[model samples]
Target chain A: MYWEKDIETIPREKLEALQLARLKESVAKASSSVFYGDLFRKIGLDPNDITTLEDVRKIPFTTKDDLRDHWPYGFLAVPKDDLVRMHSSSGTTGRATVIFHTLNDINEWTNIVARSMYMTGMRRSDVFQNIMTYGLFTGGLGFHYGAEKVGALIIPAGSGNSKRQIQLMQDFGTTAIHIIPSYALHLSSVFEEMGVDPKSDTQLAIAFLGAEPHSEKTREKIEQFYGLKAYNSYGLSEMDGPGVAFECPYQNGMHVWEDNFILEVVDPDTLEPVADGDGGELVMTTLLREGMPILRYRTKDLTRIIPGPCECGRTHRRIERIKGRTDDMLILKGVNIFPIQIEKKLMDIPGVGTNFLIVLEREGFNDLMIVKVEVQKEFFSGDLKQLEGLRRRIVEDLKSDILITPKVELVEPGTLPKSEGKAVRVIDNREE
Target chain B: MIAYQLSIFAEDKPGRLAKVTGILKKGKINLRAITISTSDTFGVINVLVDDPEGARSILEEAGLTVSMKEVIAVVIEDRPGGLDRLVQLLLENGINVGNAYGFVLESRKKAVFVVDVGDQLEKTQRVLKEASLETLDAKALSAIEPFHYMNY
Candidate 1:
């Protein structure tokens, strides 16, 4: 249930020694990996130059586009024969990027994930229903192995079908449920409709929500409504899925699994590393990845490292809540709008349906942002004037809610295209 | 009997509804049947009251968007075809129904149809009354029951 070394309670000097030792070993392994070896040689920096954990950042940073540009098998560190299982990232715009896992790598990932679960105060006796989709994406399998590793009975309940999920929760006496925050809120609304208060009816003690950025306002609201301790977990397909770091009981921030991943904060614009307490882009170097070891991967996620020991006694470093990304994807009307921000605002509106899309277009040099939201049946009525008024109200609400004004187009339910994979939230029609 | 109908426009935020109702309460206009149809922009609340003209005055004086109309209330069978048959009568009599809404009075074993006709209001009323249909006045309609959806 814990690492061999007392990472949470270790002396500061000892922890630094462990990090340095792991950093040296990681650099040696990186030099042998064909991908890193070639890239390091091109940059004229030998892997031997990385003697300390701090020296690891002197090497060039890796990015998702790095894996994408490399394509199918370019980033593989180990031979295909050594891989026990494979997982891929759900690249929305292009072809999926794959990650290979050797048996030891899987064990390390699971142990880290199990430690994450334990850090959140979950027990081995607790039954977990992993609602994350278990397919090409690593969320399902990563949590699956980790929960089983923690010795918990897992339901393996992939996302969707809220009615069935509720039934399973009631029948199985499920103590823990893992899902994205939006879906969890949708399920809470269903629970309210069924005249069943989920907080009291079921025995859900803790809920892990991630794979997306959610605000603290929403976190508190979800916790209040569901009556469960909700913790945030951050990860990506490049870093081996959603157990990179997890929030503990204090809920101050998530504790990064330092033994596996080395965390860093860098100035988003300059790409230069920042101080501990300052907010910047998070750059992670996988210290113990086998299938695809990423060296100084530019995650583009905005958060800083929390220095000093946490009140929960976990010496593992904590990361601040993610603020925003730095990519130049879409800048409409001077508003830095991410799809996740709009989704969070929409979820807060009572009676708004699940499906929505942010349509971005350019007409005669003017940027037009339209939010195509699905209107549920209850919102429809025999009165016309009231319906017209509600239309205007929803537009104003969204404008004030997200701080970005959008033309709210109320379409019929199921009008928007639903995704079997990662839901495509933004549609930019501007010419590339 | 003549019944009055009032259409009031209010902002679609939470406390705005309470303010509108508070004005009506102070004016002592009893609201019988009311339905608030909502869209993304605004809410249109249609109300049948004991004193529509008075309600209109009170709402307008309070700077609310208000309108008064002469709507005919016809009592018909509560079952399905009762409304279809009445619509046939209006069409057969050359009365064009512009906008309409209905509600069932379960205790009275009847459904009340509120109709806004196109320039044939008198003829529509005469034809319905001749067919032994009872018309409800604003006072009687408003005294029946208060609207709950608009408030809660």
Candidate 2:
């Protein structure tokens, strides 16, 4: 019943052999690219140098800055005519990183995504509504082609427009949905507003939640609210997105497809490998990528490898859900935001005092950002409307920069907690 | 004549009220009436203090956001319809009371009604003057003695 049972249930020894073979090929393919070509040459490495899986450690880890520093095409392995598509992350931090794919690469990504979807009991007879955005973001098109490959009657219902999405679901009898966990919980209220109970009114039996890490309690709430089995989908744009790893029906953790990639968890600070089941940063190397073969790319996502084998019996190793990031980047409503961006925006506005705090909280399935700013004594004009106008300005200006509206609060100068060394500017009260 | 009241901006939390009261107590500020208006996270502490400017400066020294607003202190009868008559006058004149509080001055004979008419303070004062109603200035309000009805 497995989608790729022969490969999925392969023994560990055989899996390692497949990985070693693919890794060598990938290394040879990657040498054609400028970034890896120089790095390999600088280290005096040949494509045939790596013989065993342990030898993978000889290559240094690739960071996000490496991709950004290379800019547009430093990582492109093939010629310009061979590229079929490229997906970019938002330039929220500084520069955007692009992932290029050939037609074969797209087909491989689509197949892996389809295999992931099919393992969750999705059938060709089912109707699938994909609610993620279809543009540059990987979550949308990654699953779009996968669900299509599964032969499900698919709806490419891009993000937003909650009412129309529900109407389409009811009309088409959509049984499965691919949505972010936060949005799924928020859309439930809209369902209640329209007086439509999703459980009885429509055929929504399966959901795949990705784009952001959520608590198990939140997952259970979504599962209970939708009357469906919710699966956690983990992926990154650096490694062809959504098909990188995914949760089986067991939902214990996500099984990474080792046939396509090599996985390692290492301590972020020391950059040394941790024992299996120990929490650390995940480093990946693309084994089957033809366009851009990334070697030992540091994913920065913190998770552990589940020690024992899974009951589903897929030889692919399972990794725990992302716990946190090695950096201070925040993911709110599927957007990557840095605290420095908020600070810069605050500095540009007049009358905003020092020591602003970003308080992120999860309130009833919604991620709430409350920006607390101190009001100078001179700015208080004995009128509530004046303060309200100031607050509205902060909220509006920040929405343009971050792509989401945040609640602005005015506090006294010395009211906020002040620390000695870093002056903790952000306090995240979101529970796990 | 215009009367003054202190409106302090404060976050809604325990001990916030106590902090403001502590500052006023040290500044020897006496209050006639007090009310709080809140919206979810923060609130405004409105107090009809005898020394509005003095209380504002001292609260500012304590690092609290304090502002002074002009309010009309009306002297209404302590009877049942006394407050309603003043309210009807306000309604007839199309005036909105943004914040208000009342306290008995001489028991059944007289009481003080403190109303913050916001931008319509001048309009409300003109309406009260036309109706021949008694209004108090800053000096008169600050000089009022509320417990004069009780001799004990």
Q: Which candidate number maximizes TM-score?
A: 2
After superposition, which runs of candidate 1 have C-alpha atoms over 4 Å from their true positions?
A: A1-5, A91-95, A328-432, B1-152
Q: Which structure among the candidates has the greatest DockQ?
A: 2
> Per-residue lDDT of B61-96 in model 2, one digit per residue for the tens?
888888888889898989999999999999998999
Worst 10 residues of 1 chain A by lDDT: A328-337
Task: Please tell me how candidate 2 rates in CAPRI terms.
Answer: acceptable
TM-score of 2: 0.78
Proportion of native contacts found in each model? 0.14, 0.36
> Which candidate number has the best lDDT?
2
Q: Model 2: how far is A13 from its true place, Å? A: 3.9
Q: How high is the TM-score of chain A in model 2? A: 0.91
Error of 1 at A83 (Å): 1.4
TM of each candidate vs. truth: 0.59, 0.78
Q: Give candidate 1's error at residue A357 in angstroms.
A: 9.4
DockQ each: 0.08, 0.34
